[model samples]
Target: MAEEEKTDRIEKRRRQSPKGEERRAEILAAALRRFAEDGYQNAAIGDIARDVGLSLPGLLHHFPTKVDLLLAILAKQDIDSADFIGHFRSDLRSLLKGMVDIFRRNAGMIEVVRAFAILNAESLMKDHPAKTWFLNRTARMQNDIAVTFERAIAEGSIDGGVDAMAMAAELIAMMDGLQMLWLRQPDRFDMVGGLEAYVNRLLTSLGLEH
Candidate 1:
């Protein structure tokens, strides 16, 4: 009887572990929806708790504060981005193509994209908790792209005379602008196609194969 009880207790813990994770995921989803529909400052934590059918305290158990929830959501997005861009290829063509594919994938995740767009704008303010996160992300992405461009230049795949950092900045700017435009009028915009065209032009200008 003692051994059986111990086994049962262990089984219960294993089941509860996944349940905890599921509840956390549900809370994050609800929080994401709220943050996307309303700006971060405007989103109420109690409403998010209600969205997941959890009491305020219950929601707090998973995420200690609204900022905690916001940061977790951003961290999850970073993970998702890494997953989307699996196995980074050092080659410029492959890297550029992967970015276009990421944009294509983003088209389907409207909520995630919307939240990102809204929060990115909001985080520009001095007091926003996510300000550093957005800044770091932008710098990191540009640096990654610049490094890839340098690699391509070294391989003679692109002209060494080209300004890698300048090109990276331009690429990121174009991507961010396209995302904003697509969010405004998704029906009228061809986000994926527009990026593809830009990339093709870039490749041609660099004297690289399309």
Candidate 2:
């Protein structure tokens, strides 16, 4: 009888663990939409809790604070972004395709994209909660992309004399600028198509593609 009770308890705990994780994920998703639609400054922790059908303390039990929630969201995005590039690390052609794919994915989650853009811009204020996160992310991205460009050069797919870091900066600038423009005129803009076309032109200029 005691062994059976222990086994049942362990089974119940295993089930509850996934349920708790799912609930936390549901909260994060709701918080994401709230932050995206209402800006971080405007989206209070109480509001997020309400949106997720949780009490303030219940929500806090999962995410301690609004800053904690925001960082969690950004951390997820950072991992996805890294995977986006990491998927095609060895293939230059695929790398370009991956960029388009990532942008298209972002377009599908336009609200989240909007949230990211707004938060990124706000982080430029220096005192923003995510300022260090953004700064560190940018530096890491630049270095990662620069290393990829160097690899392309070694493979003879990119011009040997080109400055990898400079090109990485330019690429990031173009993508961010295009996202801003696309957000303003989403219906009229073809962000993924435009990015694909630009990368094609860029590679052609570099003599990697015809």
Using TM-score, give the best candidate's number. Answer: 1
> Candidate 1, residues 19-64: lDDT per residue as tens digits?
9999999999999899889989999999999999999998898999
Taken over the whole model, the C-alpha lDDT of each candidate is 0.89, 0.85
Model 2 whole-model lDDT (C-alpha atoms): 0.85
Q: Which pairs in model 1 have colliding backbones?
A: none
- Candidate 2 TM-score, C-alpha based: 0.90
Instruction: Give the alpha carbon lDDT tens digit for every residue of 1-210 in model 2.
Output: 799999999999998999999988888898888887788878888988898789999999999998999989988888767666678767666776677878888888888888888888888885799999889988987887788889988988767999989988888898999999999899999888889889989888887763
lDDT of 1 at 155: 88
In model 2, which regions exceed 4 Å deviation? Answer: 1-10
What would the TM-scores of all predictions be?
0.92, 0.90
Candidate 1 versus truth, CA RMSD in Å, comes to 2.0
Overlapping backbone residue pairs in candidate 1 total 0
